[model samples]
Target: MTAAEGHGAMTAAVGSGATTVVEGRIAGTASSARVTVRGGRIHRIERLTGDAAAVIVPGLVDAQINGYEGHDVNDEHVDGGTIRRMAAALWARGVTTFLPTVITAEEERIVGSLRAVRDARALHPVLGHAVHGAHVEGPHLSAGDGARGAHDPARMRPADVAEFHRWRQAAGGIVRIVTVAPEVAGAVEYIRQVSLECLVALGHSSANAAEALAGADAGARLSTHLGNGVARTLPRHPNLVWEQLADPRLSAGFIADGHHLDAAAFGAMVRAKGVDRSLLVSDAVALASAGRPPGDYRTPVGGEVTLHEGRRLTLRGSELLAGAVKTLDECLSWAVAAAGIPLADAVRMASENPAALLGLTTRGRLQSGAAADLTVYDDEPSIGRTPANVTIVAGTCVHRGPSDAGLAELGEIPEELR
Candidate 1:
């Protein structure tokens, strides 16, 4: 069989030299181009004259990930080793950078988990580069039943800036994003203060439209999985959903996985928020066991959960969603093919836009001088049994995939990477 048929052993050269070359059509444009990478950055890009079926796009940046491939971030005993493994699992699936999310756990667990993530980054350069920071998604959320979703309502509490400082101190300033409920006591002030150092977001709330806008005015610039985190039933008119979409100051993060939103609903939201203001987030939890059969399972994060026939995860006895199960790359494909989103826009939502939201100017982009984080789809991007091509994290060829089985076969990670 030829090299191309082998899924890129000879087709793509990773670590080829201080400088490497890749030629393809940039996503969202008709122009085919050649991009040169030197010393972990894009050195140059030039238009190429050829028939190139390959599509080169920015690397995917997932804003919220609780865990992946059975590594649970919120597990009671989570440590640096868990984070190290999760980063590698994400890399194989084409997620170059992700925010390891910690939800409404106890105060001790939250800080301990953040410290572990910081230690993981300190101990491994690859993980340090791959993990942007920790996203604290709870403890500041509403305690109300329906609005709290799968989170333990008993663990919910009013927003406290003192505890927030402890989180920053523990993570070595790695707490980059925080999600809160505007209606909660002290939340607006918390947003006002934390916004100076972090990306303040609003989520898991029972806030009315005016209250939601107040949070946005208080420097809450992003919405966490906007359409999904609120109460199951809300006033038909003037709800947080409509208010969030209409507000120009806030960028909305969306989960384009099939179970989250159908094509028409996703299309409407994208149009409402405008393609430029919308971003994609997986909101993934640790359930991606490659080839692990779908069935019932007990988990520490969301007790008594079931991984269903079609990759949707839910509480064992209820219709409520436990958490997302799809990877960011797969979410992008569904947005384009099933959700009626334009491929270019979907790519941006999955990559560039999310990076920009978090203030990472050089990440999730395709340009000269940007970090050489990239994904090359063999043809046009699509989801199948394989990743379909090569993925580079900081110019290091990390994934050349046929299946996720590569993780076990890659042998022991060198000490530095460990």
Candidate 2:
């Protein structure tokens, strides 16, 4: 069935209502529960028959997303319509909230992208509701080789409060996150200033332990994709990785897709950061599941890249990774299977932890008074093995898998998704 048809079918099944009832085993709890949703908020949760096998968890919240389904957040030409399409696609994957991350680029492009996202949110309710805020990942990062990732070195610059003000203004004051290299000149002061308005993260850095601690003291609370953006080799001790992991003041985000970190490394990170302090970030790019044929393609910043195994995208002819291609749902699955983390903890890392990081109180929970954004899976161990059978955002059933035949009949695929 086409995506549009699927969406319509799901919508018809879950008509607009003052209240709705959903029955399933709640994540992080042992027994099944009947959750009542009213006015887009969870009104009540009551224990039900424990035999029900379906798993219900809060919808995933992604802290960092560059692009998806052919829409690049940093693209100068990106528009509101494109952002809306991306929102719909993300809904189908059980992501109810996310940040549209803009990486290092020219000043004009950054402002334009922020404005485009702001306009998209205003014009499309779906995009607006799903987009938590804007994440400025660069134009303030280390210029070293591996530390820079796919960002253009020519565009790299020191943190500037004036530029940040312009970006926040363009984004309609919804810019919630900024990533900077702590060792950069005036970075501590920058973090101190931005921390009042948004969360600050440290990334793409060659900072020493002292510098890392200093940034944390300055209100830089997160380590963006901690283990991924750094020199290939590091000093055995007193390295940036160890520094961030050892610091309890900083929570760390990781790209849990299999390619970003091996099983051993993933386990180690989860151990160091502990479940509560770790966050899962997609860090996906525009070509994610774009259905482009498996072959080499030149990206605007990542140089020549290859799409392999139908999922992995990498810089061509090198062991160096390019960017992530999986969604947060896929990453969650991998986290449970590969990292040996409990399913409940994995869900918290994806939802609750990030919500707390962003200071969003109404989201990332399935309790009373919380927003009724939930994902229902078919069975146990739903992490990597099961897809979301139903995804509801704010008490609205926005997506249902093809298995739900009771919904309206399928229709043609949406042009945007195609």
- Write model 1 residue lDDT over 196-264, tens digit each, in one string: 999999999999999999999999999998888788899998999999999999999998888877788
Q: How much is 73 displaced in model 2, in angstroms?
A: 0.9
Report the poorest 10 consecutive residues by lDDT, candidate 2: 1-10
Query: Residue 150 in model 1: shift from native, Å?
Result: 1.4
- Alpha-carbon TM-score of each model against the true structure: 0.92, 0.91
Estimate, for each residue in 252-308, the C-alpha lDDT of model 2 and write its tens digit.
Answer: 999998888887898899888898899899998887763567878776447688888
Instruction: Look at candidate 1 and tell me the lDDT of residue 286.
Output: 81
How far off is residue 342 in model 2, in Å? 0.7
Q: What is the lDDT of candidate 1?
A: 0.80
Enumerate residue pairs that collide in model 2: 5-411
- lDDT against the true structure, per candidate, is 0.80, 0.79
Clashes of 2: 1
